[model samples]
Target: MPTALSSTDEPTPYAAPGRVAAARRAVGDVAILFQFRRHAVRRRHLARVLSLVFCAITLGAAAVPALCPGAGESVGTHAFDIRLLLPSAWAGILVLNMASAIASGGGRELISREEAAPYPVSPTTDHLGALVLAPLNIAWMVQAWILLGSVSYSMPGNRVVGSEILTLLWLVFSTSAAQVVAWAVEAVRRGAHGIAITRTLLVCLGAGAGAIQVSGNATHLLDQVPTRWFIVGAIDGWTWRWAASVAVLAVATVVAVALGAVPTHLAARRLPRDEARMETDQHAPRPMPRSVLGILIRTDRASVWRSVPMRRGVLVLAVGPGLVALAGDLKWSQMTILPGLVASGGALLFGVNAWCLDGRGALWRENLPAPATALFDARMLVLGEFLAVASLITVVVGGLRAGLPTSYQLAALLCTILVVTVQVVGGALRWSLAHPYPVNLRSARATPAPPAAMVGYSARLATSTTFTSLLFSGCAHVPDWRLPVIVALPCLLWSGLRLAGTRQRWQDPVTRARVVATVAA
Candidate 1:
């Protein structure tokens, strides 16, 4: 039996609160630095070097147009003025940033929640880490380059310097604001009936935007956009108004960053009901497949569909860019690029680490008495089918807005779909075999590879796909339909050769054992 405590021996009531506060303060304050250190330690030297090199190249590309004389003057044709395009470009970038932030259910993480579970990683830390990692995305980087290029090429020579500064500030402000909104959205999404509420809100927003476009109010809206002030301020040069605008944006960015943490904290406190439900739900067994290949394909298909990230990514890849294309009413020449972009995004979902979908079960999978080639074939088939379906959806949606195509245009578009799907499949399989990382796809925020490696992979894929699409885009202009067919043959042959090589490697017993061991571990 314990005796009642005397006044002098009473327990401190504030002890638990004090400890919690201290842990929160300690981790959130240095979270970015800690994450950076961990990443640096884990990442390979070659990947680090490649990422740095890519950043340098991207910066140089963005800067060149501004530095070159007459670049801005050369942009406008007699039919279209550069100034008229500025507001739209600015608006597009902001929309892209917001869409990206919202789609990831806030933003992608530098360190996943599971990894941070051992530490008292505060919500503020999680938010900041997401912000830091946002720029790693290929789409984000491409849009940034476009925004900078547009600003550099549209502004007058003397005004270019001021406009560039203004544009960069706007980028910061927009990204911060988007993050704040994303956090709020995530907070709401974790509440009761949140998924339905959020889905309804998104649908409403999309419908309203579509209505605005359909009713011919888009131009009127564009004219009244706040981005116009940035242009006006920059063009006027060295004025109090310009200085004030810059100051306001800086303050707003600070405010947005701070405000984002509030919602992040709230959201973190609640359970992720949707993800939890998904992970816990039971599934009825399907009828048995007749053959080994059929069973393997069915298993792979289920894996792709069941994973949160894969499902979300596939939906976004299928729909997001297509909506953009539809709104713009892009021509066949321009539409040829969509398939490549869609395919690249699809491959990034899980194709790059195709074998890792099996996770620790890879060893069990390898021991099954089936032909090794059958396993490889199943994965490839599933991946290719996944990509092809997404690419087809994008094309169909965009084609609704695109005018009827000429023979040459039609051939180019059809061939583009085939060539890009094959190209991505071959490349993805090769990378999956050569460099596989074990990643759990159960988390909505999980990446198929390490962030640093993902950067490298995305860069290579973007470069190759963009070039291939451009080639096809150019081919769409030729009068003869046969030109596309002729061009596609070489690309198909190259991709086939690569796939064959990957298959050969997969058949080898030693290499197969090593991959199985690594992924399983």
Candidate 2:
């Protein structure tokens, strides 16, 4: 039995360092388990699993160079100069790390923040600790270790050791800076208005980046700078040069720590205080029409138009056409790619997660006397209409910019659009059935669909777009019969898409049950 005595007596046992460390580890392990459970229970568990497998493969590749003797030199030297490639690789990896963090819902755990708050850790330290332990950090650490191995492979003992130490230091600095960006974005996205403003700014910035990319001005500017200087300057055997490089790195790290710390503290401090707001302040919603198509349209409009991610996703679909029009020298063939890309992108944005948004409540629709297949068909119909309108706008704008197409060209363009639309719709529907994940309508940040789905859709779209563009580019060179064949195949395909989509979406009881369970919950 424990007895509380005087006021001077301690109320509880002090948490020892070992106990504290063990508790932190236990909490982290639980958090990881929770993430796995969350993904496992989703309809798209396979996609999430595949995504994890892919990341593991990537990390494995990075580790091989470091863990195996002479492997780095063998690969790095045979393919390219290790020294020359290291700096660029480091910079590229840093960008990749930040993108991954953003894509993976910033890979942050708010629970860690809450847990650490009562401890001796300050907000800044808590922020840094979260980042350092984050799964995303594994990628960058592998990159740093790979660099160290490359240096060890190419250099003598002292230089190798020095380079390794410097690489580790730089990795910390770069990753800390990335954490700042991630936390700040998370803070902004914690509010509806902030998400809208941030996403709009992002779209504007993306347009600017696209313009710069196409103009080749950035390449030209980069060429003017001697990028190899830092790599070459740092590892030179000269003691003074090495010392200067180390000094420069030290100064940079210090500056980076400051940069990362300030924003992190500010963002972390603001995050818990942010009161999430919804975008329900629309002008009185339009009255719902009686038809199935009308009901589907209303449901989707309310879901998408008010949501930040869906709205922004819709906005991004327009970017393809804008870029095509703004292109300095647009080829007729290149103009063909815009419609397919836009259609595919639009389909992917809402198609994959729409069913999941209705979670558990979907069973309510089953009781309405309308077959589940009808509901699915109605959804497809509504989505098809949206894609059709967007595709038409893109084609019209592109054709106008290209100057009115001749009869043959117009026919070819129309055929291309039809083919793309059918393929995109069919793919989206099939993919949606195969992989749906729960999404919260009320959440400030939109649900992050599995990375595998995003990558899979993008790759398929890019391949199809490229093939169509190249095919159309050579239309004048291809036999006349081929154009007629191309026109006929898509029309035939379009007619069967409905039957195919229906079969995939509603054919199996298992699939229906899973979707029903997901929707109802």
Candidate 3:
């Protein structure tokens, strides 16, 4: 000012060196928070992961009493085996986390195409931010809780700190490993290959691996040594061992980060080109099938086959029976429950997402002369056919495995079919009509149904399954009489409720329009 300096020529205050770094970190943190919000929008993903997390914690907590030392006894210095119970419970969680990450298009930064064009942050910073947030996923929390339970039951109060530190290191390693797998999968997707075939094969392999891990002691390989060492170290209060484990884990983490960086860099480069191309492709009009029923079936079927989220549900239907058969001792009680659970469970899942899967296509369907009931019914019809086929196969195979008579198997199959049909059609359609939501149908990226809708749908399925379970159990017992009545009562109740909901939704054009508009947007 003394020299009357020009506006651009004024001497600037020297920014503190630490302040610049801190400001950059703050920017990255905000960017990640925004990404997390967008990532959490899908209620379906959260529901599944939450349910599994609950189950894992429940199992771990339940095991604590059994595993804990008796009162007045010092915690054992000997190693404990988590392979017996914890692996199967936690494996499902790990698989779900990995699958969800891959479906959501990998563990890349949350910046959108518009913001990413200029790439405000360097790739190194962007990737680091993503890795930091990777563990923030609820799945990592599930793993953390499992470790906490393990440590609490195995180590005395004074030694818990070292155990917890070890647990944290393991969580970091697991999250980093899962992120690496996700990045690798995303890289594959962006590679020059048939997307469908590669993805389908990958899905199958993943499902198979997850099943093996869940149904068997596959995690024994990972858990056998460190788990034992950590338990022993915690019990012995060996701080040096804990420190050494942390050092090893740090080295491993650096290696994992380096390995993951390749894929991250590749995906980042590929994402812009692929996303731009996709944006162009999305602008084109899509062809609708002739009949309303055909449109419903084809559209839903295509989306299920093409999209990873829908495909995952479908895999549950297909893989569950085989898993049950292979894993079970094939006793009558177990087999009797298997068919109904698998059949009804699959239908319940399909129903949960039935209406939501329509996505932008809802706009086209809404303009049709047909009523909402017709649309709902058509969707149910497709689901019903699938259920019928899957249930039949499951019942027959399960019956054979359990050595049940043909007549009994038929009765079980018929009962399951009727019960699932009524339960899914009525409960699902009714809920769909009552609370319709939209999702991205065309994109292969996973989109979860709304949280409220998921909760409602889950409640409906649970109630329906309870009634249906009675009938299913009755069928399994091969009742000489009263099987028909067993099935018919719930069927009638479900159908009546379904009809009531359908009619209500059908009569509300405003709600229907809202659903369509929400989906289109």
Q: What TM-score, computed on C-alpha atoms, does each candidate reach?
A: 0.91, 0.59, 0.63
What lDDT tens digits, residue by residue, belong to model 3 across residues 412-490?
5566566666656665565565555555433333223533334344545645665666656666666443564566676
TM-score ranking of the models: 1, 3, 2
Q: Considering summed lDDT, which 10 consecutive residues are worst modelled in model 1?
A: 71-80
For model 2, state the Cα shift of residue 503 in Å.
4.3
Give every collision pair in model 3. none
**Candidate topping TM-score:** 1
> Quick one: best lDDT, which candidate?
1
Q: Single out the weakest 10-residue window by summed lDDT for candidate 3.
A: 71-80
Write down the lDDT of every candidate, Cα atoms only.
0.82, 0.57, 0.57
lDDT of 2 by residue, 367-403 (tens): 7766566677777666676676777776665554467
Off by over 4 Å in 1: 1-44, 72-80
Model 2: ten consecutive residues of lowest lDDT: 271-280
What's the C-alpha lDDT at position 512 in model 3?
72
Q: List CA RMSD, all candidates.
A: 4.1, 8.5, 8.1
lDDT of 3 at 267: 71
lDDT of 1: 0.82
